[model samples]
Target: MTPSTEMFDPATATIAIVTFNRSNLLSRLLESIERMDPKPGHIVVVDNASVDDTTEVVESFRERLAPSQLVYRRLETNTGGSGGFSEGMRVAYELGSTWIWLMDDDVEVIPDGLAKMGRWAPRFKSIQGRRYDYDGSEFYWQYRIAERMGIPIPFAPAGFDESGYKPMNSGCFEGMFIHRDVVREIGLPDPRFFIYWDDQLYGWLASRKTQSVIVDEFVLRRTREIKQWDMGIRHLNASSNAYRYYIMRNRAIIKRYYRALGVYNPVLFGLGTFMTFCKELIRLIFVERTIRGTSNLLRGIRDGRKIANDRSWQPMPPLATTSGSAPR
Candidate 1:
């Protein structure tokens, strides 16, 4: 059936937010959500073991938003964004949501963002909304990548059409609205990723089976500064040791999955990897000027290579790693 012919209620969806040690931001996010014209049926907050007053903040919102409108799950340990999101999405799905909208605690939804997405939801299984910086400027997220190889094409932007829906190969978690059926098919985001590239992999999985697109609707305002240093050829963001490790280590996993699915390109992947290494090394040596940063990059690369080459590694099933509860 086509989306135009199907019936849907904006309130039937669940908005899942994964957060850690950011109560202030969470408060603002909840405030924004409270103002949504058609509020989501439920708001699932996956607290990644924050030692702060996150619980208290949630309780405060629960009082204002009503306990039934907000559900909180506090993890026993700190799972990075990947794990938090995995658990959050799982819980939201189990709560009988037809759609799950995933995001971090760092963004504020425009009052009508969900309303806008609701208008576009029926047409695509995976619908990604546009993002903007805190200054209200649109974020240029269209980086070019080898379509089949899944590697970035030099000096190119992903072909994005401003007029209509454009097919998406990958997307970020911020303002990403996905159907519950897609989760059942592809599984949850891998917690093993710990942080980087997990969303791209998840998006790729969705794109493989369903129509995924980046809609021109504005949904989120990123509160953080855009982070990127410079690749030898282009500027990218600098990162922490943990981010460096996962990014490098997880590339092999992404490559393996793409190849296993018959879309991997060795030449393109290899070239992308080489370029990434050079750019990161240069960032560490010149921009960052930290030996520790350099060490982390190299270590992450070494670990990533080992993971990529592992013969026994296999993808985990959806919900395989969830440490969260079903919605109430």
Candidate 2:
């Protein structure tokens, strides 16, 4: 039998993209969407108040992808990727989307990619699709959470069998397909995260409510190219200082979630955080080839300590119980 509660109309699925000043990349993504066999019914672009030709680029595609209702919600302030996805998902939900596809502006959906993803919607409430790097190599995304550290660790069994799908707990916003019911239960991605670890926690929370899985279906191609430190099994992309900062600082935020879930052990998590820090530090020196933002990393740990110390911290309330700007 089909999913008894949720509907699965490929046309009614909404693709929620979070974009910034990358208009060229945005245009390419929109063009890819325009080519879908049965195009998504809605396209919600949450602009993080980009001060560029982003508006012009989005407006240009508005008419060409007609009847699909391309919406451009430019935020008053730059809320970063975390806020952008949270806002984008909220908007799609209010637009009556049964399944919301989330992604950044740097990728293009491959031919029939959406169809491959849609094929399993009736059986799963949350799904993650595979992606390709700029060179067409499979981007290694298989991950399982390191619960003690509240971080993602690469999983074993790199390849799947004939089933073409495998169970997963890690979440990558680039190609996560989730149902409205999941949102109703967990609310939006915490905007306060503002950057890093947001998708990991969001996907983890979604997994707690449903059988989340990552399929072998090739869904999209990365358009932007960045130098990565080849690590044999996977590649580590060099990141900006901002990425370095938020990623380090977000550890405390993750701790808050695990604590709320009653699976926290201070000693274990504390040890895991240090190991995680050391690992990322190696990545920086090896990939970026500099000891930049070392202070920022240390500062993040200090601030995270404060957050963990706070006794009043609370998780996002369920959307079914409250109302905020679902889309603005």
Candidate 3:
């Protein structure tokens, strides 16, 4: 079924936020949402397993807001970004919402964001048959190829405009709107992603199913700075190790699956994969320079290559929900 084409109603859209352990940021985001011109029908917050006092903070707001104004769920373990958003989307769907607005806790949606979405809804939906529907299928194939080759697909642009507002390559979860029908067709975020790159995967899937856009009218305020890891002992550390494991492992799986379908372009794919690995190696040797840097980088590269070459690798563990902690 397609999303309803009826008049836009704030009561039919549910705004969902996925948060980790950032209580301070979550509070700010909630405050911003509270100030929207047309208030959301419902605000659903899914807390990944957090050790912090996120539950207490959310409870404070629950006490103040009317029952219909807000809803919160705290998972038992950390489900990373994918799991949190998956659960949040499920909640939104169950609420009978026509649209779902997904955002990270660290992002503060502009006051008119929701209204702006309503304004552009018709324009987007109108293009469904002519542009959105046809292009979506083609875009998915292109995206799969790009991902396999390690090419960073620009998210915001979605190939719509040269305007610098490209939808992020994979992390649109920070601030994205989902039409109900899109979710019905595609289902939830792939839980295997756990954390990194989950947003890109979802955006790629949604881009095909409906008219998704990175609206110029609404901008989410990002509160944190992302630090790039250098090549060194730090790169070989636990956090870095886990990050490498997922990125390499997932990409390999994506590559092998496409190859089996005879859609793989080996030359481009190999070049892309080689370049990516080399870049990582350089980053370790020069940028990070930790004591175990080279060794860790090699290990990650080896594992990634094995997965890509053999086309057989064990899947990562299923994500678990963490206590409600604020995102950082």
- Top model number, TM-score: 2
Q: Give the least accurate 10-residue stretch of model 1, judged by summed lDDT.
A: 319-328
The list of candidate 1 runs beyond 4 A from truth reads 1-4, 152-162, 226-235, 282-292, 318-328
Looking at candidate 2, the ten consecutive residues that score lowest on lDDT are 319-328
- What tens digits encode model 1's per-residue C-alpha lDDT throughout 55-122? 99998898676433799999999999999998998888878787789999989888888888888776
TM-score of every model versus the real structure: 0.87, 0.94, 0.71
Candidate 1's displacement at residue 289, Å, is 5.3
Error of 3 at 227 (Å): 3.5
User: What C-alpha RMSD separates each model from the true structure?
Assistant: 3.7, 2.7, 9.2
Q: What are the lDDT figures for the candidates, one per model?
A: 0.77, 0.85, 0.60
TM-score of 3: 0.71
lDDT tens readout by residue for model 2, 37-118: 7788899999999999999999999899876899889999999899999999889988877789999999998868878888
Candidate 3 Cα deviation (angstroms), residue 150: 5.4
Pull out the clashing pairs in model 1.
Answer: 187-318, 227-237, 228-236, 228-237, 229-236, 229-237, 230-235, 249-304
Off by over 4 Å in 2: 1-7, 321-328
